[model samples]
Target chain A: MIDIHNLDIDMGRARVVSNLTARFETGRLHAIIGPNGAGKTSLLKAVCGLLPSATGAIRLDGHDLTALSLRERARLMAYLPQERAIAWDLKAIEVVALGCADLSGEDSLKHAQQQLEVMGLSDKAETSVFSLSGGQRARVLLARLLATEAKIYCLDEPLTALDPAWQRRVLEVFKSRAAQGRTIIVSLHDIGLAAQFADDLWVLDHGRLVANGEPEAALSDEVLRQVFNITGTFAEGRNLRIDPQALPEHGA
Target chain B: MRVKSLSLAGGLLISGLVLMGALLIVGDVPLSGADYIEAITHPQSLNGEIVWGIRLPRNLCAWGVGAMLGVAGAVMQGLLRNPLAEPGILGVSSGAGLGASVAIVLGVGLVPFAVEASALLVSLMMSAVLMAFVARFPDRQALILLGVGISSLCGALMALVFNLSPSPVTTTEILGWLMGSVENRSWQDAALCVAGLAVAVGLVPRLRAGLRLLTLGEETAQSMGVNIRHVTLIGVITASVLAGLSVAVAGIIGFVGLAAPHFVRALGLRDPYGVIWPSGLAGGVMVLMADGLIRVMPASGDIRLGVLTSLIGAPLFALIAYKSAKSWA
Candidate 1:
């Protein structure tokens, strides 16, 4: 379990994540959803120790996160950033093996191969990442994330550039990992998919946590109207449908 | 991939050995196989004196400087995550050159190896400035721009040194040093290169894993337990030392570091770890061949090794830039 209390993240003079307190339980897939510039990515970055400006207490499994060494933190949590442009022409398997960097070379390669197979990239394992399509590269990156075998996985927009089928498959992989008692925290833009696949939802608006609970309770009508500025109909056994609407004036 | 990388490495090693052998025999005073044996056995003989006193040290210096630059280039490219990054891009070479010029013009030879000592000090100072910039910005583009800025500043300072040169002889000496050569280099120069190469070899293991992780970009590499600051510090220091030592021994040789990694990459070793040592070998071969060519050429004035390397390296650099731009497009 991860516990965040009174967290504040700042970029330059602007605060990106305000006094946010939340508990992320293990064995659950928690999805953070928000519109652009709503601190979704900032919150995720803070949790992963990527944000040095983040202040307040973050405890992972009852230990202070800030006190832990970077290697120890990495061993506990793996992060996949949204930007996926690899700088070199590393082979797919080689890129994935970086996730298991602590392992012996042969062992890391073996684990990386397994993860690549998990992502349905077995055939592309030896292919240079530059030659792969964007979607394939995304999968390759996802495989790298999975290869970490960390207790907590923080993925920012893992589904970007992926096809619908692959997106579902990726979610299923995360769901399975969550089932095995690992905590999965993902910042996603796809509200409908978050509702379908996530066990819990955290909604943010203007650097503040607006709502947190099960998707049905957290993504309330007020959240849709106030945060997203969209009216949405969400019912059990039906697809979520949202309509874009103009923001209502407070006086009117 | 392993097979291909190994084969490429083997090819480069064998080619470097052949080039070295050819270079030993094909100098201005051509020596037969018997003469080589005699030169090795009879050190008091005239041929032995020529071979031992001049040719060996010069060739060794060339090989050492080339290898150092090549490895330094590979490390710079990997650390910056830029295909075009090299020691020169970071102004380390120019800073060393400026230092040497200062030492020469000011007649600051109060101590042994004063020029070399000054060059190393300045290059290291440049690297320290770069490290501070990296810590402040942590952005690759910004780091690259800062490097360009430093390079320009060093270039201007070097020009000032030339303008204020006390005598024509002093100016000529500075000019000759800037053009870069291993000509008249002694065993000390060769030893300096060997020391730099040894340091590079020691750094390779420490550098390999981090560089491989860096290909994923800094943030992701950090997420995977890489210490970005540590890696950057080691990389900059190692590269600066190698480039600095090369300049101290052979003046301001350019493009060998930039071109060597590319040649290794072209031979199917794309990963930073696989590229480094072979890149060094390729660089040694390249300089040996260039030196041999200069010796065999019929030019009126001596064609400096630095000029020949740039002549070959600049075109390759352009081709690489074009390819990178095309890929971006």
Candidate 2:
């Protein structure tokens, strides 16, 4: 479980995440959804200790996050950033092996190959990442994240640039990981997907956490209308779909 | 992969030694086979003195300086994630040149190793400024721009020193040093180069893992628990020391650092961690071959080592740029 209390993140003088308090339970897939400039990425970055200006308490299980060393933090949680530019012609297997840094050389490669197999990239293991398509590169990065085997996974916009089938496949992978008792927090832009796959949802507006609960209740009509400036019809089960509509004149 | 890289390095080192041996017999006074054998056996003979005191130290100095620059260049490129990044591009060589110029123009020889000490001190200061800028910005383009700015400033200061030189002799000496040469180098200069190479070799273990992780970019490396700042600091300092010592001993040898790693990459060692040793060896071989070309050339005046390296390296650099442009296009 991860706990964040009164967390505030500042970039320069502007507050990107202000007074945000939330608790993410183990064995759950939590999705954060917000409009543009809604602080979804900032909140995720702060939780992963990437933002040095973040203030307030962040605890994992019972230990304070700030008290852990970087390696220790990394061993407990893995992060996949939105930017996907790799610097060299590194082989896909080598890129995945980087996440298994604590393992022995042969074992790291073995585990990396296994993860690649899981992502259906076993054939591309020896291929350079520079030559992979945008979607394939995203899958390679996701394989790198999975190879970490961390207790908590923080992925920012993992579905971007992925096809619809691959997006659903990735969400299913996260769901299975959550079933195995890992805490998975993913920030997503697709409202229908978030409502369908997420166990719980956290909605942000500007810099505040406006709603937090099950996806059906957290993404309430008023919350959608005010925060997302869109209308959505919510229902039970897996039949929830957000219909596209014209925006109001004055906005939310 | 590791075996391939090691074998490549060993091959290059042996090739360099063979070239050095062949060039040992081609100086101004031609040596017969018997004379070469006698020169090797008798240290006090005239031929012995020419071989040991003159040619050997000069060849060793070239090899050592080239190796240092090559390793430094590999580290700089890996750290900056730029194929074109090298010590010269980072203003380290120019900074060292400015230091050497100051010592020469002001005649600050009261202290031993004054020129080397000044060169190292100034280059380290340049690295510090660079590290500070990176901390604030953490952008590759900004870092390159700052390096160019620093290089321009150092170039202006060097020119000012040249204009204010005490005498024509001083001006000539500074100009000769800036042009880069291994002529008349002594055993002490060779030993200094060896020491600098040793320091760079010692830094490999510390830099290897971080550099490999950095292939995924800085943010990802940091997330993987690699301390990017610590790695960057060590890389910059190591490159500065190596480049500074090379400049202090052999003036401003250009392009060895830039070309050696590219050559290694072309040889199929794409891992940045595995590229360092082979790059150094490739650099030594390159310098030895260039020096041999200088010896065999039928020109009236000696061809400057820096001039030859630039002539070779600039074209390779342009080809790399053109390829990158085409890929982007």
DockQ for each numbered candidate: 0.78, 0.71
Error of 1 at B296 (Å): 1.2
- How much does each candidate deviate from the true structure in C-alpha RMSD? 2.2, 2.2
Model 2 scores what on Cα lDDT? 0.86
Which regions in candidate 1 have their CA more than 4 angstroms from the true location? A243-252, B1-3, B32-34, B107-114, B131-139
Residues A1-252 of candidate 1 have per-residue lDDT tens digits of 999999999999999999999999999999999989999999998998988999999999999988999889989999999999798898999989888867876898999999999999999989999999999999999999998899999999999999999988999999999999999999989998998899999998889999999888888878877787777787774356776565554322
User: For residues B96-202, what per-residue lDDT tens digits would candidate 2 score against the true structure?
Assistant: 89998898788874455677678777887887888787666665677678889989999999999998999998887788778787777788889989888888878
Which candidate ranks first by DockQ, i.e. highest?
1
* TM-score between candidate 1 chain A and the true chain A: 0.95
In model 2, where do residues sit more than 4 Å from their true spots?
A246-252, B107-118, B124-146
